[model samples]
Target chain A: MSWQLTEQDLPDLARGAAVLGTGGGGDPYVGQLLARQAIREHGPITVLDPDELDDDTLVIPTAQMGAPTVVHEKLPRGSEPVDALRALEKHLGRAADATMPIECGGINSMIPLVVAARTRLPVVDADGMGRAFPELQMETFGVYGVPGSPMAIAGERGETTVIDTGADNKHMEWLARGVTVRLGGVAHIAEYAMTGAQVKRTAVPRTLTLALTIGRAIRQARERNADPIAALAEALSHTLYAHLRVLFRGKISDVERRTEAGFARGRATAQSFDGQHELELRFQNENLVALVDGTVRCVVPDLVCVLESEQAEPITTETLRYGQRVTVVGISTPALMRTPEALAVFGPAAFGLPYTFTPVEEAAVGTTA
Target chain B: MSWQLTEQDLPDLARGAAVLGTGGGGDPYVGQLLARQAIREHGPITVLDPDELDDDTLVIPTAQMGAPTVVHEKLPRGSEPVDALRALEKHLGRAADATMPIECGGINSMIPLVVAARTRLPVVDADGMGRAFPELQMETFGVYGVPGSPMAIAGERGETTVIDTGADNKHMEWLARGVTVRLGGVAHIAEYAMTGAQVKRTAVPRTLTLALTIGRAIRQARERNADPIAALAEALSHTLYAHLRVLFRGKISDVERRTEAGFARGRATAQSFDGQHELELRFQNENLVALVDGTVRCVVPDLVCVLESEQAEPITTETLRYGQRVTVVGISTPALMRTPEALAVFGPAAFGLPYTFTPVEEAAVGTTA
Candidate 1:
């Protein structure tokens, strides 16, 4: 089914996308403002189902690439993504049938919405990553053999660069990262142009609709004076992420963070009220691994999300401050993302974590109970 | 006014280009090999006079960009410049009628010739900078109102990037420099796409012919046992760079050099035979300022060249070694390039030097004597 994503849906979409962000993809609030302003000016955007498109349809995924910490301070001019889209279109000499999120997380999820609203192109209700990972090549589209170029990157003042390289996706990321750093640590990019059939085969379908459902659940729970964390878990119970575990409920004790090489790299530590239980989360943009009291409870290819203890509002890596009350949650990733081939691209070892790939269900069993 | 540039002209062209390089623009020997091989494979290239071009003729300038030190080790595959040219042509939907050197210095002077040979485009007998400077914006085309983009850059492995920015030329250099570093410290670029009228208005005219004359003068001087340095000055006396002075004749005492931020930057000191006079040459790829006994003898937008004291062969910055006997020369730049408008872009202060713009003639007066 198709749907119209109006101004009313932005708040819920942002909240839900942030949850899926798993502590990366930049702050959703900033992206929400850009998307809302674009929607108000250009009218609502249409969200198309991945299955509804013909195989020949061209789909371009658009996102923000840079440190989340920097994106917070250097607000985009709100036209960079559209500029990138137009540049790519000009280079290809063909208009994109639709735009989609490269990753369904925080700002990236909203970026495609902003581009779609401005360009009057429908956004597909799917994404390359159902839950965000840090690097470009970690996406299913890349892992499944789709090239990330010819990619277009745009800066705030209308400076645009189009890269068409014979290099692999990793090299593309390296090249684009260098450009992003030169563009003041942030850039809007449109890449991984794919046909509809490729999208259907490689993308995490229904993630956009899934985000809206999760957002609605959290909102409804908060309205009824119920537990939002429980609502969030319940929302995931019927979806692809069927296993949800609250890894730790506590206040942030410490955060050692720095913006280096165009990424927000750091670790955050959360301690229980009694200080007996501790959880350490390591990240490079998105949370890669979670260790609970020296035991590897959750690792990448799975979600390690931190949300406010009460309201269940998600906390981005950039916003993980000391003394903040939070509930760390671990959710199982979709089956498609957990396959051997998929894990090879984004699994625990891919992030230099020493642990092997373990399902969130198996990893969280005794501890959550 | 036009001529055929065969493999036979390469040695002379390279030698003259090295003189004009003013101690930068990569090693001419490497470029000579590439151009010679290209000419051998693709036949002789036609050198076109700027005045003969139709007003609407598209003339693209090509050059090698990176620290000259790196280019010595990472020889290009001889195809990057043509790749960049083709990519730019594809982007603009127009074929280039001719190719020209962005600078008439060292490897860059030979780059366009190589492109012209491979692509069958005529080589323009002109250049943006008659003498090389380190940065991209220090060119007559940029100083006199031509934009440096839409520019195309190509790496050795066929990776191509096209930049179209609303930012000024300096920012474009910054953006492109970052890409160059990621492309392994060297890239072939085609930029400053100008019409024949613009080329005629802004580019330094007849520089290709001037370089060949300089080379011939040195070769004949060496063969006749005449003073090569005197021959070099005589060669320049008939050209735009008419004022020439041998600033210092000495053995190199010390060199403080390092590659940083994608540039080979350093200072070299030379002491006269009697050890009574010392000259310090400050360079960032190309010699920028020369101080004889702590007094400014010559600064940029003028030519500050270093050559073997005996042979008069140009010595690039990377090749400047301790104990080498050398003669430093200063020559006046073309009057067009010495204008206040041009000075604002490539003058002393533009390079963050404390001195003001003084014609090399006036600055060198009484110093050499």
Candidate 2:
């Protein structure tokens, strides 16, 4: 299906984008504004599925690679992503046939639209990461063998760096970060070289559909004054099992932050169930694991979202703070993240959890359903 | 040259290990203890250069991949590396020709010896990182195209995982961390598929020689009652011109810490030079960069070292705290790390700095000798 960005798609896209963020994609507001501005200037963007492309179609998954917190204060200058894509195209000696999101979460989700609108390329309806992560390589696309280097990183100063370091995605992220910080903490980067066939092989097919449905669910919940959790559950009828639990309900009592390797590393302690329990959340870039009463209940690759009970809106780990009431929800990772290879990459232990292979259903079994 | 470990190697090894740690390789005490014990039990390890290897030889870089803090308390059962290597060999359906350290900093420097003594394989007198970094993939070897995954990750509990998510190096780090945490925050890992050609091409040639010399200089300094800085400067003659810089002479005032993505991330503000100067250090699995007076004085791939004047010993960022008189020194990165390609991966920008390369020499020409 062709995924065009109509005015109607904007709201759903923003809402869905936030959910797919996995509690780490930067504020969707900035990205939303950027996308809106671009759409208004250039009209709706066109999105295409991998199947719609020619065999040699040059598909690049573009993103922002540094501290998410930096992105809020250091807003994009409108031309960075477009410039990055052009730089990448120049490096490749061929124009991009399509553009895709590296992730469908945070600012990254909306970035593809901005790039696509400016570049006049169709935005792919899929992403590298099924959710957001802290680094460049933590995505479904990378797991499926998409390269992150040979990447074109563009700054607002009209400078572009085509990073092609072999196997060191962190270094690339590190280098990109310098430019981002130089550009006042936000640099537009376009990366991941793939042919249409390669994109079809690696990407989570139809993620745009999922994004739309999830976004629609959140919006519908708000419009009808319905329980958003139930709406979300209903939306994922086939993907999620019937039995899901609200693992803990509490207010954040403490948050500790430390920036390591330029990525935020921290933990938040939540006093929940009317002070009867405490849930601790650990993060590096993205929230990787959640510990309830000293036992790991949710781990990376799965979605560990902290939502406000009243509005059901996601609260990013960076935004989490003391005295904010939140409901911890754990959703099982998609099939792509559950494969032996994916689990080996992002499973519970990957985030330093002691347990392995316990589905959210099992991990949250004892919690209130 | 055939290298043999001895009681004399420990002190020097510790000193050199800290220098190689690049500021965040974690406490070397435990690694030294483990290596010393292993040496006492299994005999001194023999280190061989990669050039001596046969073209068909199998070389595995083995080390602990997890939080250094957790490693101190969760201590290994002495078989984690051996187990990880054995599992690796099993997966490869062959025996390893040799083993080597991924980094020469902290525990990683000694781990090669532990594995060598246990497996009866020679430890290569080279490493991936001349200095230590905080994650699995932020190494020169990784930049040289060493794969960090399809790794053999093992725990003392007999648990083993052969991770093969075909992502870049950082993803492997995340995956390894997940296992480390699953195993209670530490795991022995054997990763990176290296051909003999790669071993010879990328392994920091004769790093053990450099480590030994640095160690010897420290020992000599203590014995002769000479200045350790002078001794170290003399020891690092090859790279000293660019690497050595006295960046700060201050006492630590505040230290903030929080864990993210299985790493300790934080900054230690040091009060030095009769003024309040903050040396901001960021670490993942190792220290990646250092900022002095809000400007990046040194970035990754270069040596960012914090030392205590009392003994001229290197201090891990985790242990850095208030009341500690620290002399922040910047060691110029090797020529290999300064290449545009390398800079694209490990420069100031790579560490999330907003500045471009202005060698430590240029930045602190007057502040340092």
Candidate 3:
């Protein structure tokens, strides 16, 4: 948790962020390039302890909510977070001293850094959710009652939107993505304004540290020619090292997409070395769950990620198509994600699937048996 | 604009709300019953002029956001909106002087009456949007920059959620629906805190008046054995109407529904007129557009309503199915809907159709050409 972010941290952050993205966080490269660009512009971010802020010090947590594929092609206005942050400060009559990631996967991790550098606010070493999720309320913060709005979305059009609804964080996620769709799929959002007291109470504290550590593990594993999955397990405290089933490392056989109420909804059918398996992933802003063979194998709050086996690179939900070889991997949902509230948000029933939640590893083990 | 409500007004409000629902919005029956129950519980709602309130008065708009189909089967935990509104008032440190509909169609119309009677607040003669939309941010207030959070959602589980994220209203919709999906597709939301000044300047003032009038027209037409469509045209200042070919009118052939990212993304195929023609309506929360003969007949922001011809009853999106002889009518998109913003949100392209915004009259007028 004490590890400082160095220039060497980017690769790991990107990988871990992708894995954590659960499949819907836009392309990690966009987030990576932005983070790298911000780091290059403002120097490496000084990760602060969650408890380091003064009681009155203001903090802003930021993220991106939209179609991940759209994000890579459209790019951000770059000034969105800064504009949103400034608008928020103006509304609140104070300036945020630090910025934090709303979620630390994919574009969200980098978006906070961009905002921090642009506004000259220090980046916090914490995030709301340890991993990525589809809706705003899916964050660990929501389980702890940290609201997501009265926050702002800054668009490239130089407009800043603030939503103060009587709904919860997930409502904010819906509203924000609607704007993102109108804004052409990438909207920089700065939300979850809190004092140090509230931040410590609700946030997934040291999430940035976890992200960094996980990032480091992946990078080191690659460098050492060791198994990256084992490295990830070593980093996560409660996680156990498990053998992976190269479920299907083959081209996507079919893809069906429908843009409904802003989130892209669809499934991808893939033909791997093992034969044909349909990988159905539902998403909002992040991948919520994946159904293989009409069985809920991985549900949200859990990471259902698709990576290129050859390069170990991340594949976003939007880019998933037929004829693209993808290695399907299942990572255990974090403990923070196992809470009853969290399950209710991203579990099988949450997405209207009839099956109840059984952890991915246990379910996979059961299936194999 | 200064129309007052009487007991006789309820019939129109119910009928009008259904027409405005555009094939979504839960059954008007529950909402009607709730409104009637509220009126019976506490006399008629005092319909106040939008200008009656002081500029500084706090006003909260509220509604139920979830699957319309679920609303009927699962009766509300009646006390949720009351709890949420009260909680929101407590958070704002003020008693709201009035309540209003976020949108004026379907469940939204009846909700304000219930809240008004429950909380003893006057129901404003206005709303954020003129008609029902699929998402929270599609309201006029949103386009005019009304915040959607610091809102509360009270669940039947005896939980109250207060969200204050910096996301846009669209994100608020996405996230709130996620909560609804989590809570079994129904959440009472209290959002859009506005002053009398903000409400007057930004909100579509007196749209509820229009809804009431539209409701009256339908009722009157039914009573007099006149054409309800003609009455609707007269009531809403609508200039365009298209009597298109009734492509199909039978039973529901099939229904495929999946809750993807909080919104119901599915298509309902219906067989009609002795199975001579087939009809398909794709929906998120509201049916955005309808395609008959592979041609876009009616796009959203306009009315694509299906009325049961024999009974002249408004058919909801949820209840639409095969074996139902539905008279599909096309109403022109309102002037507000033709704006670039409106087109972007619910226009043809928004519905993934390959046509520009054209009135149903014009679009269908050319079909015979």
- Give the TM-score of each candidate: 0.98, 0.52, 0.54
lDDT of candidate 3 over B160-259, digit per residue (tens): 5455554466656655665566566787889998998888776766766776777777778888989876666666554222233233345566777765
Provide per-model DockQ scores. 0.87, 0.02, 0.04
What residue runs in model 2 are displaced by over 4 Å at the alpha carbon?
A: A1-369, B239-242, B276-278
> Which portions of model 1 miss their true places by more than 4 Å?
none
Error of 1 at A48 (Å): 1.0
Candidate 2: tens digits of C-alpha lDDT, residues B1-369: 576877558867877887777655656777788888888888888878778877777889899877776776777767889988887777666788889888888888888788888778888887777777666766677787777766777767555555444546665565456545545667788888677788887777677777777778877898889988877887777642235777777787887777665777776677665675666666655666667776777666677788887667888877777798888787775666567766665665765757778777666665521
Residues A19-118 of candidate 2: C-alpha lDDT, one tens digit per residue: 7786678877788888898888889988787677777788987887667767657788678888788877766677888889888788888888888887
Clash number for each model: 0, 25, 54
Cα deviation of B232 in candidate 3 (Å)?
A: 7.4
Question: On a 0 to 1 TM-score scale, where does candidate 3 land against the true structure?
Answer: 0.54
Reference-based TM-score, model 2: 0.52
TM-score of chain A of each: 0.98, 0.93, 0.87
Worst 10 residues of 3 chain B by lDDT: B239-248
